[model samples]
Target: MTVSPSLSLAQRLRLWVSRPAGPPAKAVQFDRALTPWAFLVPQLAIVVIFFYWPSAQAVTSSFYLEDPFGFGATFVGLDNYADLSRSNEYRQIAGFTAFFSAVVTALALGLGLLLAVKADKVIRAAGPYKTALISVYAIAPPVAALIGMMLFDLHIGPATQFAALFGYDLRVGIDYWDTAFALIVISVWKQVPYNFIFFLSGLQSVPVSVREAALIDARSGWRRFVDVTLPLLAPTAFFLLIINVTYALFDTFGIIDVIVKDKPANNPMTLVYKVYLDGFKGNDIGGSSAQSVVLMVLVAVLTVVQFRLLERRVHYG
Candidate 1:
């Protein structure tokens, strides 16, 4: 193709960019084929060492009853799995884990979106407002749980003291339901900033022209948001839904550990934490390995379902 004689440099550049018919090109090439493998070896080694190795060992260990002190093992076949299937405590913990994950993901995503919308509308002191909101996420999960413990510390905690005004006693770390409430609150608080950052970025990425069209088409702000903004944000929302579910399942271990304070006897715990407790504290390696395998399957199934079914409604622009 030939450029017009009158075309400016910027117009010429645009024409070049728009001309898309071409084979793919590689930017970098290695003199030897082994060079590419050399570059990949480190990352591949790390994945094998950290992920695949442990997974294989866990699968092997699950079928055997081994001494906690590194002694000989007896093959137990499916006994460990059978024990988990029949345990009432394991069923209760599974129920709590499902409830906890659902509640935390919902509250975190909802509050994050709400805050992002409000922050997007702020013209003055936006930096400080966002900084204040985002700083909470920088605190580690265990640290957040520690702060939560203090807030519900029964005697001098402001939250605990405030409960006295309503003639209600707040007994966190003691009462099962109260401790669960604290766990949910801390988990949501720890996760909201991450969700907020994503939601705010998604909101900001809406084209100004699209916003103007939406405004003209729908006079009501809520209607415009529901009809226009939400569809555009669907991809981001779907991605965050997966991330938040995984976070609730695995990343909240520190928070639960700190809240329970090494004593999970009377407190609510997630399945992941129960694995650690049984493995390390109770010295039941075979059972913990079996539990870990079950969790791995559960997570895999959940991910497949999310991708296969839940992703149907996500419309990416």
Candidate 2:
């Protein structure tokens, strides 16, 4: 109670020194840490507005039956989905879509890996090979489709003439199965080149020392590739696998639409094509939206499965 002024002043100074400065202990350099957000905000907004907003609209639209003008859509609950399930066309389309995606993915990946491996060995002409391969990929899908149709279509298509030269009348137009196969061929041709680029990059990224070590260990070419190269390329393969599958499902629609619009019986008319036909030709917006939702769900499930199962095995540097 009778403290000296000097002692009191010293105690006050100690308390002032102990006190936290400014606002409650903020993060160190808060402004600097958050500065990246200024740059990120525009991209984030774009993604939300264009990608997420449209996806949300598509999902929402699936539950409603829209008027012809799309101004007023009446909520239909699950009727559109129910109809899709009951329809034979939808079942056929789904089956074809699954088959086409699976076949094309496998073919593209296999061929791409092969091509990439061969190209990797070519120290002299690697650039030319890559250029030729990627050039096909750079062409517009519609243009590719048109060219594919011209090459394979029944009447005046060269594929038919080539078949004749081999004493086989390969009429793609008349034969549903042949047409389906042609679609597969076209799909594989267009995608294999694109997939090759990724595979090539992955191959190139593999350490030369590891490969040399494998060779020194008396590993044959096939064994070395199987044991070492494949393991190293697992991540790239998995990535391309998912991407190629998605492309086969979605982007290949343009080619399929061009070639098989009239031939509904052909197996190339996949789920996306069904959605397009439903929305535009059949004028069934709700049904198309439901089909799209189903396709989206399928893709989502596949993507999740890829991450869950394949991610552990992938070797990323």
Candidate 3:
């Protein structure tokens, strides 16, 4: 069927008009909106400058050697990494870091879980308990470290006084084993409060009805907790696991440094602390950059593993 000439012309005109008009065509449209980009540009620039740029520079520096003048960097092609691996100091520091991280993460998570569960069952003054528990987390790490140092320092700390009562000679300048244990203790002390907050939030977020249903089915206390409540808290548990592990690895370095600066080769010095020592103290920029890369890889792997294992178990609301 052939269209009438008038109808054909009318259709053509409609199509032509509907084909967006000039300035209106480019006018702040949703898909072409500039506001979001305008808002994002500053943040993007900051990230590029602070995070991406430095990260890129570090990666490049990892493969190079710096001359005495610091003007020219020579390509070393993984020599820094090879030297790092061969260094007994690197192995010892890494081993200490790993052991400390593992122990502190485990203790923090365990104690946090216990506290969260106990707080969740509060018959009275739960709010006070929660506030007190979480208050530790609000304290600055440096302040906390100073307090710990004051408390545990062998010469005048309360811990030394307490240990003396137990007939234990605990002098606190810097004992390798003692400092390592103190670092772990202080780490757990700081981290447990943070983890408790998350765990408590997670526990409270679990549906009351589901827990009641479990009780109706004669699932009491431990069984109900294991079978019902635990699965619900899995996502929170996984999150805290990752966060606590990362904190134990990276954030605790400052605390360790304050508590064990003189004992870098012995105490619970982490990979981050080692990197700082190499780059700033020892002037081994290449070695530090390589260690930083290794640490990034380690964290990335652990994060990926956490998601892989817990993704299926997490129940999204």
Candidate 4:
């Protein structure tokens, strides 16, 4: 590697320039096939074990008659589903489910969007408003239910006392509609924060110039919102509709458990709760599995229908 002292400075410079950059600095290759997969193994295993395995077992168990004890299982073809098809109670449960899901989705999305709009309009101290709103989301389902329970407890609840002040008795458990209202309140309470976050994010994405232009050209604020802002929010609204439906179906399990004093009563039972009531509580494993399968189908169908039908109307901003 020694250079000749006899060579001129220009010659030395030329020689140095002519030398290669030493094996291209061993260009690092990130094309390893196994590294990405090595990272994904744990997640894949967890999904398979927790989600797919149980789903498969539920499907399999739905097709057979399982003994109360874990040992004996007999293939019952479609009898469990057949019994469900003929049951008047199952039909009523389905009806209640449809109504409850629709109401929850509407209340959650509507109130959330309204709250988000008001929050968006706030010119001062928005942090406190958002924090207060989101604190409800952090409340655990059982805890939230318990709080609602205490608030509406028949004998010693502030809510009942507040109603008494208005000359109306608001008993939580003793009245069917009152109980229904409480469940709806809890369901809506849990969903509003989630919907608020999404809707606020959506609203913030709308350009201020668009709002300004709408306001300048349109006669009124309501007209501008209807023509411009609401259309742009259609996609967000539609997305939330799907989530709210799924939440109504499945995610309200704990809320229902804590809120309903009478599980056997028809007032507050959804399909998800019915599955638990039948399977774990009643030990009708086969029938409950079938019911679970039916619920799974219903949810899948509902999602598909909403996406297909509503996506056509959505305006992506």
Candidate 5:
């Protein structure tokens, strides 16, 4: 390629930056071997400090019962995990966590996909519509929880009043299942916009020529979508599946914290929140560390399974 002599330096620089990348070479050599390390070191340092170091510390702590006040620690090998296994409350919370994660992930993904498909087809006021749909995502989880609390408030909340019309009392914090319902609704609502943004982008990235071909081949709209459009979306769907699961597991901490008002008595809560309550509030440092290690292992295994099993079905276009 030849540069235009008339072009300004800034314009030339922008052109170079925006130039399309070429196919990979079979073999390439760097002038300096340390050059790669120069670029990688900063990211490696961050990962080591933020992730691996903490993970190591948690594993160490999990094997010992530490004083909450940092007075001392007793080496109690595997007792923390054993306690978790034997405790009925821990088991119950674990069960709830699984159910909550599944429900929230499903709802968030399904609704987001549906909305994205609709938004992609919109011909009028698309900008405002997309903006309105995604605006909910900008709100913090705690704020969303606060909003949910007000909406589900027993006396003056619209949702509560609406439920009353059907002769059903919607007591959010007071009733276990009602609180779980509120938590799930708010969590799903918060997550849907993120999934929508990704799904919309994925839909838009589908080749127009491919879409035309699918249209010509399939007489039924649903058939065309299921056979062509859906397969094309498999990669995005799989990516979102992992993300949604992680979000449901860990990112809903603030939402649960705000809604439960720091009192987790008989209310539905996930494992991440349980770790917080145990470590910070209950001051069971060792137990919480054990829980954290458990979560880390669980997430890691889940990710591996997703890559191994789910990726087989994902046909990357």
Candidate 6:
């Protein structure tokens, strides 16, 4: 019958593969060199606009002393970074960030592994239960923070009341460590569902034959798990370690903000939170920009270390 002269060769091939009653073989061949870039242009533009441009601005701003009003930029050339390095408050912020990230990563990874193992063991209604467990990850970060705040509210919180009965208060506005601890718990809870999704997928990918062989050799279930299952899950655990640390470092700002109620009040504020406070609230643009640069460098260094040192133990299969 009649063929569409406008149809490109790739489009015609796709149509032919899907249906026999497709257009005739007379398809127009288009230039290939620019086709790939034509498809990529939209996405590349978005990335440049949203990511690269802002990053370049931050890098440039870090070298300048500016105000919150986005005017009167004077090039200071490393003075911002030098001042940040010498500040006691900045050092305290770094300590807070380290402790918070460590605790959140450990708790999230540990709980995720435990939950994934348990979920894997479920033979009945496994799909529904696993879906339910992972559904929390679908919640937005700010919304999750709100939920966490509500749950641990000192006066009206159910979890707080429940904890009070056990002689433990998990509410805010208590002590510096207490606030930090509550924030850590919220961060871990928010991260666990994501980590659980990955760990469960990794556990399911482990060859059943290998597990059965381990079962035949090891009499104890825990022993078989430690020897066979844990090793196999190492790659997944490593990935989640990086993600959890990132979430604790950057994404937990919402939860920290909610808990602090706008005033940190001598609380253990993280480096990321300090960046926000200094730049937005305190109106010290140069300091915040420098902090952002430091954070970027720290993450890059840690990622390199993970690839170099920790990745050797990862079992792909």
Q: All candidates' TM-scores? A: 0.89, 0.81, 0.84, 0.85, 0.86, 0.84
Check candidate 1 and list the clashing pairs. none
Indicate the TM-score of model 6. 0.84
Ten consecutive residues with minimal summed lDDT in candidate 5? Answer: 1-10
lDDT of each: 0.86, 0.79, 0.78, 0.81, 0.86, 0.79
Estimate, for each residue in 161-262, the C-alpha lDDT of model 5 and write its tens digit: 999999999999989999999999999999999889888888998988998898899999889879988999988887788778778888899999988885
Alpha-carbon lDDT of model 3: 0.78
TM-score of 1: 0.89
35-133, model 3: which lDDT tens digit per residue? 879989999999999999989988998999986458888899999989988998888888887798889889999999998999888827579988898
Q: What residue pairs clash in candidate 6, if any at all?
A: none
Clashes of each: 0, 0, 1, 0, 0, 0
Cα lDDT of model 4 by residue, 1-317, tens digit: 22222332233333555676756444875778899799999999999999999999999999999989888999999999999999998888888878899999999999999988888788375678788888988887788889889888888888889999999988677676788788898889888998898788788888889878887899887887789889998877766776677778878888888888455574657889899988988899999999989987875566556655776777776
TM-score of 4: 0.85
lDDT of 2 by residue, 1-317 (tens): 11221222223333555576756565664557778799899999999999999888878889999887768889999988899889987787778778888999999999999999999888478999998998998876677888988998677889888988999877665576777788888889998987799889888877888768978975578987888889888877866776777788778887887777575654458777788887898788888888888877876576556666776777765
Ranking by TM-score: 1, 5, 4, 3, 6, 2
lDDT pick, better of 2 and 4: 4
lDDT, residue 198, candidate 6: 82
Off by over 4 Å in 2: 1-49, 67-73, 262-267, 315-317
In model 3, the clashing pairs are 154-172
